[model samples]
Target: MVKVEFAAALQRHVPCAPQSVAPGTLRAVLEAALAAAPGLAHYVFDDQGAVRKHVAVFVNQQQVRDRVRLDRPLADGDSVFVVQALSGG
Candidate 1:
């Protein structure tokens, strides 16, 4: 199973916990995790189902490059971290 964790900053708004989801593409893993806290989907994804511009997702410490497709493959035991990106001066 893939281990998915939301950053503390993000959790403050939606209150989600780290969870293990079936190994699959990034989209699948996110869907499983969000199932527990459906409201969180709004913070992570935009209206078109693409990752929000202010959100970032990392797999095994590497940042994912495809925000729109979210096709990055995840394997069992892989660690996925979702965080709200900081911006502004």
Candidate 2:
């Protein structure tokens, strides 16, 4: 199983807990994890189903490059971290 965790900053708004999901693409893993947390999807994805500009996803501590498709594949034992991206000068 792939481990998915949401940052504390984001959890304050939606209260999602870290969970284990079936190994798959980033989108598939997230879909499975977020399915248990109502309203959390709106904060992570936009109307087009792309990751929101303010969100960031990392796999095994490396940042994901494809936010639009979120097709990065995950294997068993991989760790996925989702956080709110910080911006501004």
Candidate 3:
């Protein structure tokens, strides 16, 4: 199972910040997640399906820098966290 978490803003679409999902690549996992929660795509990604500039993802606690790398493989029991990044000066 892949555990997914979202920031509070994302919770409006998925009440469960932390959700378990079937195993798949990061792309597949995110696609399935968007299908499950239609509203989330707009909130997390841009029209071209790239992760929003303000968004960040972590797989097994390691930050992912390449949004195009979504097709990267994911192992079972891995935790996937999607959250909006905070910025301030």
Question: In each prediction, how many residue pairs overlap at the backbone (N, C-alpha, C within less than 3 A)?
Answer: 0, 0, 0
Residue 28 lDDT in model 3?
82
Residue 6 displacement (Å), model 1: 0.5
- Candidate 2: misplaced stretches above 4 Å? none
lDDT at residue 6 of model 1 (Cα atoms): 95
Ranking 1 against 3 by TM-score, winner: 1
Superposed Cα deviation of residue 53, candidate 2 (Å): 1.0
Candidates, ranked, lDDT: 2, 1, 3
- Cα-based lDDT at residue 15, candidate 2: 94
lDDT of 3 by residue, 2-88 (tens): 877787868865664456778898978877766766767788788888888889988889988887658888878898888878776
| Highest lDDT against the true fold, candidate | 2
TM-score of each: 0.95, 0.95, 0.84
* Model 2 lDDT tens row, 1-89: 99999999889999998999999989999999999896899999999999998899999999886889888889999999999888874
TM-score of 2: 0.95
Q: Candidate 3: minimum summed lDDT over ten consecutive residues — where? A: 12-21
**RMSD in Å for all candidates:** 0.8, 0.9, 1.8
